[model samples]
Structure formats: C-alpha cells, structure tokens
Target: MSSHPILHANKTSPFGDLTPDEFYQKHQVLHTHSFISTNNKIKLYTQTWRPIAQSQAHPPCGVVAMIHGYASESGWVFETTAVAIAKLGFLVCAIDLPGHGRSEGPRGHIPSVTPVIDNCIQFFDEVRASNRHLPAFLYGESLGGAIAMFICLRQTGKWHGLVMNGAMCGVSRNFKPVWPLEKFLPAAAMLAPNWRVVVSGNLVDRSYKEKWKRELVRRCPRTKRVFEHPPASTALELLRVCEEVGRRCREVDLPLLVLHGEDDVVCDVESAELVYELAASTDKTLKVVPGMGHQLIGEGKEILEEGFEVIFSWLKGKIKK
Candidate 1:
C-alpha cells in the first residue's frame, strides 16, 4: 500500500477566500498520514495524535475514532481534541470522511447514510484487526456525532465507549426544509446542487467565535464558494439515522458522554439532553459548558483541556469498572 499525505489549496468558499497555506501552517503541529482503505475504492486520510509514550512496539491505552462535521475535514475539526485525548494515553485517529479532505469520493456528495456508516464500521474493523491491545471508542463532532450514534446503534457490540460533542439529532429550523425537499425534490436540487442559501446564526464567545469563524473561512473555502448549495443525498440520510438514533438511544448500552455548549448556535442543547436522558447505559453523563460554542475544543485552550480531562477521567473510570 502506498502512503503519502496530500495537501490541497482551498478552492471552495469559506476557506478559499483566505490565505490557505497560512491557515494550514497556523495549525500544522499535528501529524498527518494516509492509508488506502480495504474498500480499495476509497482513499482515507487520517491525522493522528498518538501519546508521546506510544510506540509501534507498545500498544495504546485505547483507540479513538474521531469523526468531523459537515463540509469539514478531520484536520479542521479536532486538532486540539486529538492532542488532548492523545495526552490521556490514547491513540487518536481523526478521519477525513469521504468527499472531504483527501478521502476519495465525489467532492461533496453523500448518496445515503448507510455507506458512511459502513465506512466507519470498516475503519473500526481495520483498527481491531491491526492492534491487539487497543480498545476502540467513537468520538464525533457535529454531524460526525450523528454518524457515530448511528454506528453505535447498528453495531452494538463493537465499541468500548462513545463521546459526542455538539451532536445534531435534528437540524435547526433553517436547515429543516432541506430534509423533506431532499426526499421529494431530489432531481431539481441535484441538478442545481450549487444553489446558494444564506445561513445566519449568533455567536456565543465573542473572541473565540470571531476567530474560529475567520479560521473556518480560511481553511474551508469550498463550503461557501459553491453556488448551488444542495447537500449530498447521503446528508439527508443522516436525518433518518438521527431519527432512528434518537428513538433507539436506549438500545446503546455502552458508556457514553454527551457534551454540548450551553449557547451553541449550530446544534440545540436539547439534543444533548435527549441523548443523555435516553441512553440505556447507566454510566452516561451530560456536561453543559457555559459560554462556549459548537467547537468546544477550539473555543479556548483552557476549556478544551478541561473538557478532555473530564472525558479521560470518565474513560478511565469506565475501564476500571
């Protein structure tokens, strides 16, 4: 298998309008590498933050499968979280979901939810077969969190635990119309998928929110550049998964931690509450970080560190029990 990390200039909206190389350089501390998936058709890119104590000869305390949000790559989503989790003695694998980052697929098309979930399952299988000592956990942000929840529901016995930050059980009202239209008006939108739509929201953390928004604009230019703005059909499938996951949350018997910002503009805090209340696991916890936004880890170094500490402590306690 050939392996080399690939870097592309930002050509899409949000990031495209900024200085792409500078944006990447600012957060270039993490290690990046690529592996060809067993499903040879898809190329997967992963950014890893392994514990300093870790070596090929010594297995990790656990393996964390990190998934990113919509229109964003793994690198863009969890740089700080990955490092923090790694410091807690785990191997963090932040994957670029298909159609984002270096992963191969139609640029921004997701035909349905099953394929994405299948890819995640395949990823876990690969990890389990490759590393004997490492237990696997799911860590997802935003839309990625929704995907993780679906995987946990469908493949119940596979994971050790699950951690979700700003998970979307349902899209906001502004984005809701797209859900139904996706099911009925598929042809019209797909034909003009680049159609533009305005998304407006308020910021919770004035400083971090502004900086993060600027960073997003710099790193993910494609998000805003597309004129025809219909998300992939697979994106709609995400809602179906979310509906099922919300109803079947009780089916997930593994330990779970659902974290959300109290003032999150992207995803409602109620979603986190629902997951916390519905999960069948007796060891679940819901933490609401006051004055933070959707990107908990990137909101601030102190907030990010404290959040990871909570997660690590919880994971440690779970392992002991």
Candidate 2:
C-alpha cells in the first residue's frame, strides 16, 4: 500500500516529475499500448499493465478488464491506478472508448449505450484471449460501472467477479436539470441529438473532494476532455441505460464489489445500494464511505486508500491469489 503510485501523483501530472517510462520502471510493471480495430475503419486505443515477471511461471493471479468513466481515457491519472493494480500481480487492460479519447468519433457524443458496450466487449475479449487459465474480473469506475454490469449481463458466466468504483448506477437528482427540462430530454434529443444540455453543476467541481485533484483532471494531456454536460441524445441514452441496469439487477450473479462515495453528488448512492440489495449474487459486497464524492480515486491518498484496499483484497480473495 505504501508503494501505491497514486500516492506519488501531484496536481500537475499523474506521474509528478517522473516520465511515463520512468514511472513504469520504478513501479516494476511492464506497460504497453496498442490499437485494436473495431471495424474496417475504427480502431480503439488499448493499454496493458503487467507485474514485472519473476523466475516463477504463472505469477499472474487473474485478468482485470478496466472501464474508465465518461469523458475519461484509459491513461493519465487513470493509468496510475492501473499501475497500482498491476503491481498487485493481476493483469490489467483498458481501452479508450470511442469519442472520449484517441478513438475517432464526434467529441462527447454518444447517441446510444449499446455500441459502447459492444466496443468494450470486443476489446476485453481480446485481452482475455491468451489468459483463459486465469480468473477474469471486471472493474469499472463511474459510467464504466454500468458498462461492466452490462457486460456481465450480456456475457453471463464469462466473468469471475466484478468491481464498481463510484459507479453511476443512477444519476443524482442534484446533478439533473430542473423539472421540465429533464422531462423534455427525450423529445429534445430527437430534435437535436448533438445539442449539449444544461445540468445543475460542473461535474469536476462535484467529483473530486480535493481542489488540487480536481485541477489535475483538467490537466489530463490525453483525452483533453473535461465533460461538462452530455449532449441531449447521450443524456437520454444514459438514463435509459441506468433504468435497464436497475431492472436487471436481479440477474447479476457474479461475485460483486460496489464502492461508492456516500456524498457523491453525481451518482446516487441509494441506487448503488438498490443494486446490491436486489442483485442475486450472494457474494456481493457494498461499501459506501461517508463524505466521499463521485470519483473515489480522484480524492488522493488518505481518502482513497481504504476503498482501494477493499478492491485489492476483494480481487485477491476471489481468485485466492
């Protein structure tokens, strides 16, 4: 825990003064990135982080397919956490979803959720191809949480366990647009799918508990996307996706861990609890830390350590690694 990379991060960079290459070397992890074709034209950016190999064979305990939140990429500060997990002896891989990072699409535009789910499945499946002998788990943060749930639902029995960090199981009322606008989103979406809607507050202001950490997100060199509010169609699609996930909670049978901030102003804490309550998985666990906000890892060392420990221990226990 003392060696966790995130602890070393500063407001200016995910690696502070260390170059990306130096950071990976210092942590004793092998980091690599590549692009995978979603089709003949679209290529999704992907990353892999693995513990530096020892003399012994089969050191990796499991494979973790990570999903980052909306308007975020698979690298930057997110990569710091990925390094933290890789050093824990698990294989971790993530992809920049289309429209969010380097992947080509209209900026901040997601007309639907189904294609996003499919894109993740395509990338994650490739990551697990050679590691079939190891247990497979899904780890998602924010909107990634919903994507992870949808993946498990769509490909039942394929995943050994799941982890959701500050999951957007449902939107917080505090973040939603006032009354009639929220009611009119679907109609507005049909009329102008590309138009961005007005939400109550800035997401970054509400997401990170620490001021510097919030600034760090804006400094992300990759992606360069600090999403303010979703376009109408994407906003409507997110609501629909949330509703579907809620309705299918009873169908979630994978070993699950739900980590949420009790005071999260973006995603409702009660909605996460509802998922935990209704999920059919007997092995599920939920930890809603009081006073924490939407982005758990973004809160810096002290606040994040416990939640991260829970995630680490939970993954290790499930695979008995």
Candidate 3:
C-alpha cells in the first residue's frame, strides 16, 4: 500500500485494534466478492457482514441492506460501518453500483437510475430470501440514499425502516452545475453521454472533513482514484433523480431516520429537512449534526461513533416492534 500516514497510523482505528484481516474475521464479515446481476450480465461486487452472535443455533434481530454513494464501492471504507452494524446482531449486506469500484461499466456513467435500482432490488431480494425470518432495513449514503428511497417507493413493504446518511434528496444549489451549463446538460448528454463534465470543484476534497482521509480514499487503486468528474449522462441522470425524489417526497411513508451533516454542501441539509417535513410517514426523524461534512468517516472518531449510535438506537427500537 502507499505510505500514507493514515494508512500507517497506530492510532485506534475505527476498524478496531486488530489488523484489517483480524478485525473482519472477528466480526464474521465475509470477504467481498463478485456476483452476476443477471439483469444485464454485469458482474457486481457484493459484501456481507453476518452477526457472530446469530447463526442457525441463534437468530438475527434484523438484516440491513446497504447501498454506497456515487463514485464509491461497497468494500474498504464502506465495510467498516457494515461491520459495526453486524456487531450489533444484524446481517449487513452491501453492493457496489454499476460503473463504480470493481463493478463493470464505463466509470461513473449511469445513463439512467432504473438499471441500478433494479440490480439492487434483485440483489437485496436474494438476501432477504435467505433470511426470511428476520426483518430487513435499507441503509444508503448519498446517491445510494436516492436508490434506497426509490426502492422503498417501488417495493412497498419490502423494508421495515430506512436510514439515509448525507442522502441526495435534492442536490444543493451551491454544488449544482451552473445555470447555462445545467440548461445545456441534456443536449450534451444526448450528444456525448460518456464525456467527462468537470464541476466547479472536486467532490472528494469538499466531502471529506479530514485531509488525510480524503487522500487515503483517493489512494484506492480499485476505483478511478481522485479525478472522478461525473460523465455528462451521469450528471444529467443525477439531476433528474434529485428532482424526481423531491417530487415524490410526500410518498415516503415508512419509518425513516435521515442523518445529514449540517455543513454538508454536497447534499443540502435543507433538502433533507424538506423530505422529513413532506414525508407522510407517521414516524420520522432528522438529525443534522453541526460541523460535519458529507463523509461521516472524515469526521473525528467520536462524532462518527455518535452518528452510528443514533442509527443503531433507532434501528433497535424499530426492530423491537
């Protein structure tokens, strides 16, 4: 691995004191591997962390289906949080979206969200089938949050609860493509779907609160690394998804927990609040923690733990019901 200080640091890792392999083994998290989506013959990368406390002899309290954000994979940094949930007696499963990480596609090029959502639903269905005795919840971050929202709407009763962290409910105006460029995005998408569309600033730098964490994330060789400018089609599709999600906010009627950083410029806190207010769900909670950014992992260790504490507590209460 590269000689980054964060990678080499002996500080108490959020991953725990043991080595990476040791921690995963202790947590009973299965090593990440590839699976065929069958929908489009695309090989997708998937990973699961099963609660050590629960087996055939014992039963899990619940299962969590996780979806990572845009330009992200389900392995590495994402797995850390999955392991945390598994430690709490829940089966946690995650999938890398197409065109991201180890999944096959033109990097960061999602012409439409339908295929991605369909792949996730198929994969999640398989997970739920295996653990039919347990309730299933959906967890997502950023674009993955949007996917989860769409899934819940399309497949009502498939999920018991939904947890969204820094979700793209509505793209912040500050981060959106400028007016003329936004107007021209559709034509450009039709003309050159795969062409890179550089935004005003890099998302990695803006999203992560810690500089080292950003660098560490960029060091991953499996992903496209640092220079991830969304493609024309991908950008246009994201805009459409945000708009559609906003329009359908009132349709969200399940138990919902929306966690967002108050300073998350990547996905506006205001948009998250709008969803919370508009959603018809009888039970809904929104926590906009102060002084945080889009990437919760980049927040200091204590705040990260605090965020998950809220998530786990909320999940536990829901599962008890």
Candidate 4:
C-alpha cells in the first residue's frame, strides 16, 4: 500500500445533469456514438470525441483510438481521459469490448481475446479511414495494452505510437491463481470454460492505492463485481496471450510509451521492463513509478496530474502536435 495517499472527488460526468449534446457543448467538445458491427456480428458500443472547431483553429492534432482493460469499459472512468485528449485538439475514440459495458455479449466472460481484438481493429480501422490525413495513436490499459501492442504488430506503420498503462504483459506472481488451480487451468477450461474461479480478489485491493477509488470502481453499474476474477477460459487465454507477447517483444517496432507501477501486483513491472528491453523500436520509453499501483487514475491528484503530464508530453512529442 502507498503511504502517500490523497482523496479524490467522486468522478462525475455531465451526462446525468444535461443531454449528450448539451454536455458536449458545455465541455466545448463534439461527442458521437456508433454501434459498430464486429467480425462476430456483435453490436459493439463505440464513441468518439473531438474538440469543437473553435477550440482549435488548426486541424485536429491527431486521432487516438483507446482500448480499456478486462472487466472495464470505455464508458466510465476511461472516458475522462478521452474527453481530456479531445479537448486538447485530438480526435479520440474508444470501443467497449463485446462482453463488457454497453456492448452486446455475455457478462464478465471472454472465452478468447481474438474476437475482442478483431472488434477493436474493425472500429479503429473505420476511425483511421475517416482521419487518414492525421497522425494516429493507440492507447490502452491492462489487457487492452497487450491487445493494442498485438494490433500494432499485426499492422506495422499503421500507428505513430502506442501508450500502455499498467499493461498485462505478464501476470504477477502475487495474483496468479493458487498452485492446483493455476496448473489445472487448461484442463479446467476445457471442462468448464465459463466457470468463474475464486481468484484475484486482491486485484481491486492492490490496483487502486486509495480505498475510495476502489470503492468508486466497484460502484460502476456497467462493470459488475464478478469481473474481479477471470473466467476459467479467459484466464487460460490470458496466460497464452502473455506468453506469446513475451516471446515476440522484439517484434514490437512501433514508438512506444510503457508506464507501470513498480509495485503493481496485478501486472508485473518486470514484464513491462522486459518488453522495453527487447522491443525493436528505437523510440521507446518505460516509466516505472515507485509505490504507484495499477490504477494511475486512482492515484493522488498530484501524482495523477503528473502521470498525465508525462503521457501527454510523450504523445505530443511523438505525434508532433
């Protein structure tokens, strides 16, 4: 636990107090939504925000496509960052993964990550097509970070850079399911893929340095508490994803910014370091903050502001905005 604690205001959005358009007007941004059809025919929820024309006389600086972590959705805390980026004269878009948030699918269950990545690629491809004249970037947190990296690898030269926040490059030893459960994952998954295992209660506790932030995350209606643990199938798939990513770290040639908490117990900092060390990209940076946990957004205001400052500065430098 971090001793340097700070209380944060309950995160609130204008969506409740005003209409969608009214909220965007008040914020000086343009907000739009689309129900994108994925390869699996899943009607995924997608949204984008761009600065109002008056906010930036120059054409938008760039376009950023965001992917949220497992059990998380783009419609909640993640939207805060999207809005901030849009207000900074960048067009930002995000999609809710099939099984999460407003997207259509089963709750808290992902049998495989392929379809999810496919969904993001489809939506992000559409966004990229519309903004072909602008530089493009990918931003992801936790599992989404790995997905973003895979996407970049699959489509070289497509992105100007990648921003990974506490990405799940590798699972931490502290959070791995117990001995028998971990060892039996493959067989168990085959037998009962959808079965929810009794693991990872500690993730939420270790993720947010602040208790209130953890509580606030738990209160999110769109993300249920059941998401705390990966379903048997998802768990097995995650291990494979990490293994494949670790093996192919040298193939990551895109400009990258990988941020992780030195003390993060969910996604090991060592994994981030490993990626940093082996990545073929010439323009790559790794920032490991001591005592910080998994959720940078849940950090103290001072730390949170500094983290975003680092991220935005890096993005601006890479995109040349």
Candidate 5:
C-alpha cells in the first residue's frame, strides 16, 4: 500500500515542511479544487485527486466519493486519505458542505439535513458520471458516515460499496448534551435555530488520540480559529438523523466496511455494532479497533497503518478491471 499520507503530516502542516504543490508532487498525484453553486445559491467547494498517469490515457481503477465530518472540510488533513487512495490508482473526490470550509452558509449551523444531503448527491453524482464503467465507492467519517448511509439508502444500488470510519451511527451518550439541556433542544431549536448553545464534549481531546494530531486538527488552516460547535438546530437535527439512520439502516444493502475505534467517545461504538447487525448488506464487515479514538488516522503510527491497510485492501478487492 502507498504510505499513509498522515505519516508525512506534522503539527504545523498536513504537508509537513513542503508547500502544497510540492506535497502533491511528492505523492505523484494531481489535485484540483473548484466551487459549485447550489440551487439555493450556496457555493459548495469541491476537490478531486487522481494519479498523474490517470490524467493522460490511463483510466483510474475506480472512483471514491468522500464526505468529511461536521466542522471538517474536504482539504487539509482530510485530503490525506484522498491522496493515499489516489496514489494506489483510484480517483478520489471530496466536497465541503455548506456552512463549512469555503462554502457559503453559517458556520456549524445545519438547520436541516435535506439540503446537506442534496448538495452531496449533486456533487458526487457528477464525479461518478465521469466513467460509468468503473466501480465506485462511498467513504465518510464521523457525521459524514451517517450522510453516506442516507445517500446509499436513497440511491440503493448506485454505489458498489461504502466505508465508514468512526461513523456517528449514534452520538455517544457521553458526548451529547446533559439531561435538561437535551430535553430543551426542541424549544431551543425552534426559537433560536442559529444559537451556538448546544455544547458539551471537547472534540479535539476526544477525537484524536495523539496530542500532536489533536494540535494539528485544531490548527486546520481551513477552520483556523473558527468556532466548530454546532448550533442548536444542527445539534437537534444530528440526533434526529442518528435515530432515523438506526431505524432505517436495514434498507442499506450495499457492501459495507464499518471501522470504528473501540474507545471512541464522540460517536458510539455500540451503535456501529447495531448498524453492522441490522444492515441488509450481506457483505458487511465490522472492525472495532481497541485503544483507538474517534479519528482512526490519529492513532499511533502502527495502528493507523494497519487500520488504513484494511481499507485499501478492501477497495482493491472490490475494484472492477
């Protein structure tokens, strides 16, 4: 497998000391960014990474549409996985949902899931259209995992497989708002939909196991000092989405690879188990790695490599000529 790109990342930059152009050259992949306007006039940012050779006559082995977690964009640390997959001869694309990254919307305010889902479908469909013959897969992390499941449920057999890492099948009880605060979410959401009031867990400390990695994620050039806490409306919608996913995951019949950290506190591991059990996908596989946190990529070097190795191997086995 191509070395996990995270291996090159430092606390200062995802590219270590290399400039963005040098970083792409180091990995031998071509990367590009663009923006698309949604029907509501929201400008969603999108990125694509492909092996340089594929830019010529050679076609890619397959296509991978990726979705990043809430508060997370498609670039910076998130695109390392894209580069890793691209180096192994597949095309990978990711989109920054509205309210995050360069997209236009209130930061961390997801008033409704419908528009977010629609935006994803709009972007992913275009990338998948490039080479209809090549097998395609959906890859999402954290909240993105839930959205990916919804996409698969809606599109049914449009995708060949799905891979979710640290997926928020359900929010960890330890992470959600404490008692009375949860009870008032409906009223709070209705009255002040944009209020950044739903607060409890510390994602940086809870998500990344390594200290340096936590610092790296916190300093994300895209987010910089932006407040990442979801507003009342988004918080309420996320809870609803989790319940809806658990209630309807049985309809998800595509091949699946569910990877979650055994010790993840931000997203429940048991919910992942529940998903693995109830999913209609006959080819589903569940792996709960011990001693890891919400971000599998931030696990110590050895663990990160092994975890990603499983993903790469799975993708290669499923690819069509």
Candidate 6:
C-alpha cells in the first residue's frame, strides 16, 4: 500500500511503453512494497515479505539480501523469490540496484563495478544498522550474484553465506569476448554511450513464456521490456565486471550455494562450475535444476520451492552448527 516514488523517465520502446496501470496489474499477484534508505543519496526501492506467522514478531533467523538482475527492478522480478526465502524463516531485503528499480541513477547506466560494490556495502550497513541481531546472508541473481561475489571477495566476514542463482561470471553466448575488445570498447562507448544494441537469442522458460503470452494478449507493454537490449556503455562495464569477477572467484572464502539451470542461455553453466571449482570455501555447493532456463527462481512454483528448500536446508545446517 506504500507508494514508491517514480524516479527515472519512462523509456519508450516497442516493449517499454506500457501504462502504469497495466504494469501494476500484471504484478498484482505478489505483495509488493518499497522503502527508502536513509544512508544513501539514492532512494532505495525494496520488496520484503515476512513469514505469515512471524510477521508481527520478527523472526530470529538470519537476514538475507536479495540482489536482482540487470535492467530489471527488484519488485518486478524478485517478489516470489523473496516470499519463498522469507517463508523459510529469514528476514529478506530485496533491493533495486542503483540504476534499476526506483533507485536514483540514469536508467541502465552502471559506470563501474566498484561503485556498485560500494552501494551494496552501504545497503548492507544500512540493513545491519536497522536490525542488529540477525546475521546477514547474500542472495544474488545474475548480475546481482556477480556483485555479491565481488563484495564477498572485497569485504570479509560481512556475510554468513552466499546464494547465487544463474550468476554471470563471464559472458554467455552472443556476447563479445573480453580480451582486446574489453580494453577499449567500454571507454570509447562511454564518450558516446547512448548507442543501443539489441541483445537477442535468450531462450525462454516455460513460466515466463506463459506470462509473456498473457501480457501480450492483455497488451501489457511493460512486461515486454528487454533487460539488456540497446546495450549502453554501462552494460559493457557490467561485462567487464563479470570478467574481473570470474578471475577472482578463488578469493571467495565464505559458504556458497550456487544454483543454475542446465539450459540457461543468458549465462553459461560452465561459469557456475568454474566458481564451484575455484571458490576457496570448502562449504560450497552447486545445484543444476533440469528443464529450467535463465530465470531459475521465477521459472515455476515447484522449481522455486525446491530451490528454496535446498537453500534453507543448507543455511539451517550451518546455523545449527
């Protein structure tokens, strides 16, 4: 019921032209809400769900930070996942990254990875300052996962554990390689950064396919927004971050739970394997859910539930010991 301030200008595209009402109706099924962070210059829009039984008395379980993917806001993509994690007895803080969601920044422009990591650290500090007793964990999806890993490597002991779903360690198929191209492309594009490139070839999951079908019939234009198309220089910066993080995976020493779909087209499954193989943490696990696509958490209720159980069991075992 709380209002989330609209910050960025509504973009115009074949997929980005939906009226506010249509967008809200498409996502009305989930209990979506927002809050502003006092510590940062940006207005942080977050979605939170507590267990029904413990909504009044905050649960004793650890706090879990849910980081969302590129071009997508936390509200639109992470409602179901946040509810699932909260149902497992944890307080969840699912925030829109600086440029996404309702946060303050130019739409889709991530100047560098360091600033993103800094913002994440600030967000975590704000959360801890608000609620001190709950141990915090990192739950990142795709680009958010990559940001979480970077944070884990840079700041030690901040997180009790890490859960990454479809994390992007390196570029997937159809993305340009990061050798000589990486050295100059991002810098050059920044000067003339408004160029838009269509990123195609992403495979659709069944659930998303159905949702897209429904939205199409309803003429819901917002649901058609592409997260990565019209690639800006900032998008290239993200790719560079992925390349750097992929090399630094061995530096992660905390408990890690990595989930990826075998059929993911946005991120290569081998990237997950690489992280599992290189992470310094002995308490690491990788789960490959079958028939799922890039959006593993939103693919289906069954898959989402199963993934949550896996994460819950792991966290419970660790917390118990």
* Alpha-carbon lDDT, every model: 0.63, 0.86, 0.80, 0.82, 0.87, 0.64
lDDT for each residue of candidate 3 in 228-257, tens digit (9 for 90 to 100): 678888899999998988999899999999
Each candidate's number of clashing pairs is 20, 0, 0, 0, 0, 2
lDDT of 2 by residue, 33-98 (tens): 998888535788899999887335656888999999886889987888898888888999999988
Model 1: CA > 4 A from native: 1-32, 38-40, 55-58, 174-208, 220-235
Checking candidate 5 for backbone clashes, the offending pairs are none
Q: In model 6, what lDDT does residue 24 have?
A: 34
lDDT of 4 by residue, 1-321 (tens): 111112213534314456556656766888888898777877999999987883335778899999998867897667767777777778999999878989899887778888888888889999889879889999999999999999998889889999999898999998888888999999999999988876755567777787667777777788858688778998998889899889988999988999988888888899999999999999899999776778787787777777777788887887664
The local distance difference test score of model 6 is: 0.64
How far off is residue 97 in model 1, in Å?
0.7
Give lDDT tens digits, candidate 5, residues 10-108: 998889999999999999999999999887788999999999877556889999999998867898888899899998899899999888888888777
Candidates ranked by lDDT, best first? 5, 2, 4, 3, 6, 1
- Each prediction's TM-score against the native? 0.76, 0.96, 0.92, 0.92, 0.96, 0.77
Q: Once superposed on the true structure, which residue ranges of model 3 sit more than 4 Å away at CA? A: 1-20, 28-32
TM-score of 4: 0.92
Best-matching candidate per lDDT: 5
Backbone clashes, candidate 1? 20
RMSD of each: 6.8, 1.5, 3.9, 3.6, 1.4, 7.0
Task: Residues 94-184, candidate 6: write the lDDT tens digits.
Answer: 7777767677776666667677777777767776777787777888887888998888877798788998888887667655433565466
Candidate 3 lDDT at 107 equals 78
lDDT of residue 47 for candidate 6: 62
Q: Is candidate 4 or candidate 6 better by lDDT?
A: 4
User: Per-residue error at 77 for model 1, in Å?
Assistant: 4.8
Tell how far residue 205 is off in model 2, in angstroms: 1.1
Expressed as tens digits, the lDDT of each residue in 1-321 for candidate 1 is 110011122223322334534433443323546665746477777666665555667557787888887656776434545655666667777777777767777666765667777887787666667765667889888788888988888887778899887887655554444444545545634665543323332222221354654455445443333312435354445556567667877787888899887867666777678878988898688888887767665455556556656667776666566
| TM-score-best of 4 and 5 | 5
